[model samples]
Target: MSQGSSPTRETSRTDNDGNDADDDNDSALGSDQYSTASITSSTYHYRQLGGRSYPNFRDVDHWEPVDEKQQESFDIRHHIYLMQNNQKLFNAPVQPRCVLDVGTGTGIWALDVADTFPWAEVIGIDLAPIQPPWVPPNCRFEVDDANMNWTFGDGRFNLVHIRDLVGSIRDDEKLYAHAFCSLEPGGWIEHTESFMIIFSDNNSIPEDCVYHDWNRLFDEAGEKTGKSFHLAERIESSMKTAGFRVLGSRKKKVPIGTWPKDPTLNEVGLWNQHRWMEGLDGYGRWLLKYVWSLSDVDIELFFTRTRKALRDKRIHAYELYTTVWAQKPGPGGQ
Candidate 1:
């Protein structure tokens, strides 16, 4: 069934603060399918950076919070997925009985999947309590760090889904191994990520453009922070090393602006632009401050220029969106 057609357990809901408000209850996921150790009570505190709030998980996680800008970007990203893949979730071959969503921002994808497969339990784990309280009965959200040892039992999940965790995960190999061991025999693991590198087929982007400089700085910052943005390019090899049978992978060129001639691509570009515009500060603020030691004013000036560059349709630059899925060996396989 399409994500839009999935039934929501609640018609209206409140914000993350548990306030009574009229909001879409269709935006959350998780139902506590697996058991994890009780998280420390000191997890709810947030750190402020560049006028945005981020989870302070005692140095365990360095991800920004699901603030207004991030929420808008998440919605735009959801739209981009529909325009590109035409589905809320991937087309993995497995029929999941239980699903795990790692780094489940806002719990939107997990919620949609729970509604789509009401029989399967869906759990979303993030560093912050950003998910709405009202959600599908089969879906629930938890605050935890994915880098630590997974507390779930072996073979507990039929499908493990991770998306856009490149800049947040320090050791992807370990994460993949954990995912491989957590899945049932013949279960699937799907990873969807985008690269920081931008490309142009027609050489529209100039050498001296701020976009190129921004990417270079971003890459260097990620390397210094030990969270490389290029991790998506190595997912296939990592999964293979974890004993997963390589299913297949696909890549799509996502434009930075509404410059594509094709209708679908143009729509994709529009959402992508909106995502970047809304997320430029949240994406770079912490990195620039902590890694590069740049002042807040300097970072703001840099992003102001970067946003202008992103709006330049003459550049025709695009980022690569890659989806890779693999399955664990069953009894028949070695």
Candidate 2:
């Protein structure tokens, strides 16, 4: 519906990193969707590894090349419950007619949003183009680079939603700033990311526990890629700094398994547990290669043990974080 053309690929003559040209004609693909394409495109290129493809890390693309069990786990329940509760945060009369879902992996949220609002036009973008063929009348999927110029005019979107981009993006500050500029005055920008570090006043992990070891491994892996797995603390501050007027922030304790006391949470917790276990297959397959100081055997063992722990309920933990919602101050006062 935007009827915009794709950006022409620029020849940067640089390797994956910022350094100058390599022997091969390898360069990152740049987008010219927005006027300031350099910033967005450069940041996007920073994550490309010679264009080598990796399976799903956070359900940001399509279903990963994982076992059927793991893939099914991703489909059973919605991870970003905050997005489903849009009515609580977004003002409905403004009721976003144009929505952009960035890094929409299975395109579930985008599909649901389109179904909920038949009049709204929804576009879901992902790197892999893994979305299902059958979608609502108003929803469509595009295989494009969100880190490039947005392909839409400035102030184009009524609502722009991005979530779980922890493993996918390096510069959260720049990303949010761009999203802020993309919205029309008084438009809404919704972001949902996991804190990854969930806690209870009553529960504490030991320094040398397997959970601790897992944490260390993940942290090292994240640092190597410039992605932060534990970015919950920075979300609010980053949104505010990006010029979003903080509308509301609410934290939910996503349970690890069906072990939570409440029924709804218990179901979600069970799904979460399954997703974590399955993620070993989806994410761990790449970890050994990408993470520093990790051997193939090390990743293999980690995956086996992590899966076993989740299956046995040994690590029935919940991801704790607050989803922050904000608005770009609109032109007219209601």
Candidate 3:
């Protein structure tokens, strides 16, 4: 979504027609389904960098910050998606009895799904132990790394959900393979992601826009980690390789500021702006400090200008969001 003189509202491509909002679920396998590790004081020992909190996980190099401000950004992003999808949790046709949310940052989606389906067992897992201790009776959270071999015993989950974890995943196919193995026959795995690059269809952006170079730096950082920020475009192929038959996929243009003519899109752009303003720094901090070799002053200046550019509604800038859901083969191998 973008800010500037109103160009035509961008249209998204979808293989199957649908309008539904969904959140991700996660679980780390143990003898009892949820991982045996507990969220203790050791897990809470987060490193405070630039006034943002980050996990101390040695296994994976997660770039995003895990502070209260960042969590609020995540919640706002959730509401933006809900508005985009007409408030539906999922488009897949099924009454899920069990759901697994991988990379379930903040655990908001899992809690909502648990409340929506009281009888269902909802589990969420992530590298950080930021999820609240008290949750729905049917919902639980685990602190675990998703890239490691998933031990969630095979054929346990009816639905596996993931969202907004593009640059964090080092191997997309391997992650999908783990999700494929954990799902039951006929179960569904849904993933939602957004392109990191900014786009404007009507030349709304100035020639000196900061976005042109900002996204490239992210790509370079992702390359160092062996993860691709453009994984949204590759979701289906990876899922297909993991033996999943495509169920449906949809795309939407998420606006950056209130630039659109439609009321709903205008609101979406407002939330998107809030998201960028509040969280983009968190999104790029680690990468900038460790990978990009930028000094503190340069990082601050870059972010300041990016924020300024994002607020310019005359730029008409937006990012593309893609949601893909697929099913594993059922009884008799379908």
Candidate 4:
């Protein structure tokens, strides 16, 4: 285990404004780890909010939970992506000697990539330090915020991967720009995000569906917070603007339940159904509470109804996910 490894997962901070004073009083907490670059600790304290544990670092305020249950949700979501992506860790065809996994929840993808390429030095960066210490020798974890100015040095990585950062980033263009700057010229940047809206092909979901209300609230919240749940669709243009040779993008319609007849789609839908049901609380609590101004009881009741709808195989609802990858211009560029 790392020196600062605790059940609480104490980690270094990347304070943006140098103002550590906040409602959490994280500055008063002891620093257990350091960033790879110059990111002074501001409010790097792990927090318990509304009875759920959030990460130590700040990314557009405290939103996600870093508890055991939430960690399991994250890992299961990883499997869903693997099943969706045809068992490939990434589509970027690069033999990376160094790799970076941005927003690496639980570090499962980073660990798997490290195992697949033992010679690669893999680093997983997240606002939370929830990754287990027992990892491949080439793999390590860091607690850093991608929304902040990256200080990981120029031309440092061969592959920079980001996933599942829906409704979190305020300025994704800046984030993509940072990835472009950090990658070696011939390196690749691959990103995946699920659009947080549900769809039905046969109009099975009713017009007055609870999902409609939740999707509306998500839209209102995104407008209020400037973090779009539909961020994945807009990334291709941003990556193109950032000097990446944009490759063909991927779009997958992941079913929410075992509603599909196809054997593969049925298996995916089953796991995806479990994925949402298990992580319901962690998924939308902060957004609904803070942005949509919903009470805890109301949020809980809403989630209960949402889960029922998700389990209704007759609805046949599916979520859309978008993935984009591009190569930096230089020798060995794809």
Q: Total clashing residue pairs per candidate? A: 4, 7, 24, 0
- Compared with the true structure, the alpha-carbon lDDT of candidate 4 equals 0.78
Q: How does residue 128 of candidate 3 score in lDDT?
A: 73
- For residue 64, model 1's alpha carbon misses the true position, in angstroms, by 3.3
lDDT of 1: 0.75
Model 4, range 2-50, lDDT digits (tens) per residue? 1233222243344554544232444322321223332224323556667
Q: Could you tell me the lDDT of residue 125 within candidate 4? A: 85
Per-residue lDDT for 92-135 in model 1, tens only? 87776899999887888999889989999999987766777788
Q: Which candidate tops lDDT?
A: 4
Summarize candidate 2's per-residue lDDT along 1-334 as a digit string, tens digits.
Answer: 1112132333333333544432222222232222212212322321222223333211223213423343354454354363335434333345868998887667767887898889999888766445676677888866555554454667888888876665666567777788887788888777777765534344543344455565665677668766667666787788889887877777777776666678777877777776776565665555555564467677677777666556654445667755677888769312
TM per model?
0.86, 0.75, 0.87, 0.87
Q: Which pairs, if any, clash in model 4?
A: none
The Cα error of candidate 1 at residue 127, in Å, is 1.0
Summing lDDT over every window of 10 consecutive residues in candidate 1, give the lowest-scoring window. 1-10
Over all chains combined, what TM-score does candidate 1 have? 0.86
Provide the RMSD of all predictions against the true structure, rounded to 1 decimal: 8.8, 7.0, 11.6, 4.7
Cα RMSD for candidate 1? 8.8
* Winner of 1 and 3 under TM-score: 3
lDDT of 3 by residue, 1-334 (tens): 1001111112221211231101012222211122223333444567767887776443345688777788888888889889999997777776879999887778888889999999999988876777776778898876666765676789999899999887777678988888888888999989999988888889897888988877787788778877778789889999999999988999999988999999999999999998999888898777788888889898998898898898786899988999999999987234
> Per-residue lDDT for 91 in model 2?
33
